[model samples]
Target: MIVKTYQINGMHCMGCVNKVQKAFISHNHISEADVNLKNASVKLQMTNKLQLDELMDVLKNIGDYEMIENESEIHHNKFQLSTYKPLLLVIGFILFVSILSSYKTSFQLMNWMTNFMGGFFIAFSFFKFLDLNGFSNSFATYDIIAKKWKGYGKIYPFIELGLGVAYLLTIHSAITNTICILILTASTIGVIQAVLSKKQIQCACLGTVFNLPMSTVTIIENFTMILMAISSLIFDFFKQIIT
Candidate 1:
C-alpha cells in the first residue's frame, strides 16, 4: 500500500473530520483514511497512488474541503484577504444597503445602525437556513451554547431571523437590543477563546456556504454587533429620559 499525507483546508471540527474520513474510505483505492482535526491533515493508505485532483474530487459532494501541499500553504491560505473575500463582500454589501436605506435627507446614525444590524442578521441567517444541519454541526464545534446543547445550534438561525425582523420593524427596541447584546456577548467570548487558543477551525458566521476560518475577523464581526446593540440600548435609554 502507498501512504500519502496531505493538508486539508476548511476542516474545523470532528464532524468535518468524520465527513472527510468517510469520503476517502468510500473510495475503493483508499484502504485506510485517518483525518486529524487538530492539525487539519489527512493520511491515506491506498492500494494505488492517487493524484491530488482525484483525491479532491472525492470530497466535492461533502463540503468545502481542499487539499494543500503543506502546513505553510495552510498558513498562507489563512492570511490571504482572498480567503475571506466572500465574508468581506457580504459585509460590504450589507453596509451599502444599510446606508442606502437610512440616508434620504441626511445621514442618520441610529437609522443606519438599525438597518445595518437588520441586514447583517437577515443575510447571515439566510445562509444558515440554507443548510441548517450543516450549520448546526459547524456551529456546535465552537459556540459555547451550541457546544452544550446541540439544539441551540439548530435554533440559532431562527433567533437571528427573529432579531432581524424585530430590528427592521423597529418594535420593542429595548428588548431586541438587550437580547442582541446578551447573545452576541456570549458568542464573542467563545470566538475570543478560539482565536486565542489558535485553533484552526471554520467560522460558521456565514454558515456552511462560505469556508471562513475562525480568526480575529470573526471576533470583530460579533463584537461589532454587540457594540451596536449596546449603543442602541443606551440611545433608547437616554431618549426615554428626554421624552
Candidate 2:
C-alpha cells in the first residue's frame, strides 16, 4: 500500500472530517483514510498511487473541498494575498465609506474614525449573525471570556452591533469609547495569547463564514479599534480643556 498525505481546505469540524473520510474510503483504490480537522489534512493508504486530480474528484461531490499536495503548500497558501482577500475587501470598503461620510467640508479625522469603527463593527457582526452557533463554537476555542462562559460567544455579535449603532448615532461618545476600549482590550488579550502560542484556530472576527486563520492580522485588527477608541477619548479630553 502507498501512503499519501494531503492538505484539505474547508474541513472545519469533525463532521467535515467524517464527510471527507467517507468520500475517500468510498473510492475502491483508497484503503484507509485519516482526516485531521485540526491541521486540515488527510492521510490515505491506497492500493495504488492516486493522482491528485482523481482524489479531488472524489471530494467534489461531498462538499467544497480542495486538496493540496502537502503541508508546506498549505503554509505557503496561508500567506498568499488571496487567503485574506475577503478580510481586506471588507476593511477597504468600510474605510472608503467612512471617508466619503466624513469628507463633506474637509477630512475630519474624528468623524472618519468614528464612522470607520461603526462600519467595521456592523459589517463584522453581520457575518457572525449568519452562523451564530458556528461563530460561538469557533470563538470559544480561543477567546478568554468565551472559553469561560460559552454564552459570551453567542452574545458577542450583539455587543458589537450595539457599539456600532452607538458610534454611528453619536450618542454619549465618552461612554461608547470607554466600552469599546474595554471590550477590545479583552479581545486583543485573547488574540495575543492565541498568536503567541501559535494556536491553529479559526478567527471569529468575521464569524465562521470566512474561515480566517488566527494570526497577527487579528491582533492588528483588534489593536486598531482599541487605538481609535483611545484616540477619540483623548481628542475629546483635549477639546473640552481648550474650550
Candidate 3:
C-alpha cells in the first residue's frame, strides 16, 4: 500500500474530515484515508495508483475543498484561531454593544437579554445575507430542515432579521420569544446531531463567508439564543403574576 499525503485547505472542523474521508474511501483505488482536521491534511493508503486530477475530481463532487499532494505542513492550532477570529470578534462586539445598549435602562436583565438576542440575530443574519446561495448550500449539508427543503436555507436569514427587528422594537414580546424558542430549538437539534455524528462540514451560522467549522461552539450559539428567549418569557410570566 502506497501512502500519499495531501495538504487540504478549507477544512475547518471534524465534519469536513468526515466528508473528505468519505469521498476518498468511496473510491476503489483508495483503500483507507486518515483525515487530520488539525493538520488540514489527509493520508491515504492506496491499493492502486491514482492521479492528482482524479483525487481533485472526487473532492469537487463533495464541496469546496482544495488539495495539494506532497505538502505536509501542520498548523492546526494556529489555523483554528485564525479561522474563528471573525466569529469570535463578531460575538464579542455583539455582547459589548448589547450590554452598552441596556446601560441607559439600568441594566434590567430582560432588556439586556432582548438586546443580546437582537444583536445576535441581526449580526448573524448580516453574514448570511452576504452569500445567500453559498450559505444555503452549506447549511443544507447538515441542517435537517434545510436539507429537506432548500428554500428554508434561503429564507432563514430573513426570518432571523425579522426576529431581530421584532426584539429590538420590543414588539409582540410573547410571540417573539416563542418564535425564538421554536426556531432555535429546531436548529440546535440539527447542530447536536451533526456534531454527535462527527460529520465534517462547514457551519452556516456565520454564513459561508467565514470558514467556521461545525462544532460545539455552534451548538452553544443556538442554545444561548434559546435560553435567552426562555428566560425572558419566564421573567415576564413572573412579573405578570406579581402584578
TM-score of each: 0.74, 0.72, 0.70
Clashes of each: 0, 0, 6
Q: Give the TM-score of candidate 2.
A: 0.72
Which one wins by TM-score: 2 or 3? Answer: 2
- Model 1 — which ten-residue stretch has the worst lDDT? 69-78
lDDT score of residue 125 within candidate 1: 97
* Model 2: per-residue Cα lDDT over 92-201, one tens digit each: 99999998887676888898899999999999999999989778877877778888999998999999999999999989999999998987887888889988876556
Error of 3 at 63 (Å): 21
> What is the overall TM-score of model 1 with all chains considered together?
0.74
Q: What's the C-alpha lDDT at position 2 in model 2? A: 48
- Per residue, candidate 1 scores C-alpha lDDT tens digits across 1-243 of 345689999999899999999999999768899899998899887544456788889999999988975655445755677878999999999999988886675887998899899999999999999979878877876788888999998999999999999999998999999989887887888888888877656788888777677898888888889889999999988999999
Order of models, best TM-score first: 1, 2, 3
lDDT of each: 0.85, 0.85, 0.82
Lowest-scoring 10 consecutive residues by lDDT in candidate 2? 71-80
As a whole number from 0 to 100, the lDDT of residue 138 in candidate 3 is 76
Q: Which parts of model 1 have CA positions greater than 4 angstroms off? A: 1-69
